[model samples]
Target: MKNIGQRLLEERRRLGYSQQYLARAGGVSAHEQRQYEQGEDLPRADYLAQLAAHGVDVVYVVTGKRSTVINISRDQAQTLMDNRVVGQEVTLDGPPEEDLYFKLSDPSGPPPDQS
Candidate 1:
């Protein structure tokens, strides 16, 4: 399993962010960012929260597993798949729009046959 620093570094690279840029965005110094990426230091809660606000999956960075919750109806699921967006912003509280909600909720099988 990758260490937390490795995961953070990978995520930053995946987003095409330089350590300096990520540090600025996360409100940390570039040296601090390097330390975090090198596993010489761990980020504080505020820094992690800042990263999350900038679209970093801090949970995955820390745990090496992405956290996901699925619970949509069939129709909603189909709609979600049909209109899938790569980096769409998702609201997690209430039910999603019909399509997005379904996709997130249901994991039954292939989408219904469309003839």
Candidate 2:
């Protein structure tokens, strides 16, 4: 299984978001975002709040499990349509549903070390 860092990197890539773009959205420096993706540091609650606001799948990042919110690229959507895998072009309104936005924004960071 990939680590948190790898998942973070994957999410960023999936969204086609540059580190700088996420940095601005998350209110962190690019260096900090890099460090988080490098597993040198974990993201905090407030930082995640910003990410959730900007549509980062924070649940997948921290837990390694993806939420139901699937953000497909236009080409992929088109391909699905071409293959008849998807019936009817449904126009989605509003933001893609994110799982547990409340939870991701709750914990201040990784749980405090008990030991």
Candidate 3:
């Protein structure tokens, strides 16, 4: 398992962020950011929250496990963020929009087959 600092550094590199930039966004000094990335110091909860707002997956940084964060939006990638997916389970919330016209109007894809 990677250390928190290693994971933090990995995330930072993945986003192409400099320590100075991330530190400013997290309300910390660049030196502090180095310490956090070097495993010399642990970041505060508030600092972590700030990093999250700046696109850092703090959950993954701390726990080495990514959180169930889904972008529930009308515009995104080709994959549809269906409401039926809750956490790790696929749930049936309702009849699932049976309107063929609605499906045709949707850009995600065609409606699921009833058969």
Which number leads on lDDT? 1
TM-score of 2: 0.58
Better of 1 and 3 by lDDT: 1
Better of 1 and 2 by TM-score: 1
lDDT tens digits, residues 11-77, model 1?
Answer: 9998899999999999999999999999999888899889986778887898898646445565665
Q: Report the lDDT tens digits of candidate 2 across residue range 5-90.
A: 88888888999999999888889999999998999998888988788777778888889987766556555555655676456665
Off by over 4 Å in 1: 69-115
Per-model TM values vs. the true structure: 0.61, 0.58, 0.64
**TM-score, cand. 1:** 0.61
Cα RMSD of all models vs. native, in order, equals 10.1, 11.7, 11.8
Q: Which pairs of residues have clashing backbones in candidate 2? A: none
Error of 1 at 75 (Å): 16
Which scores greater on TM-score, model 1 or model 3? 3
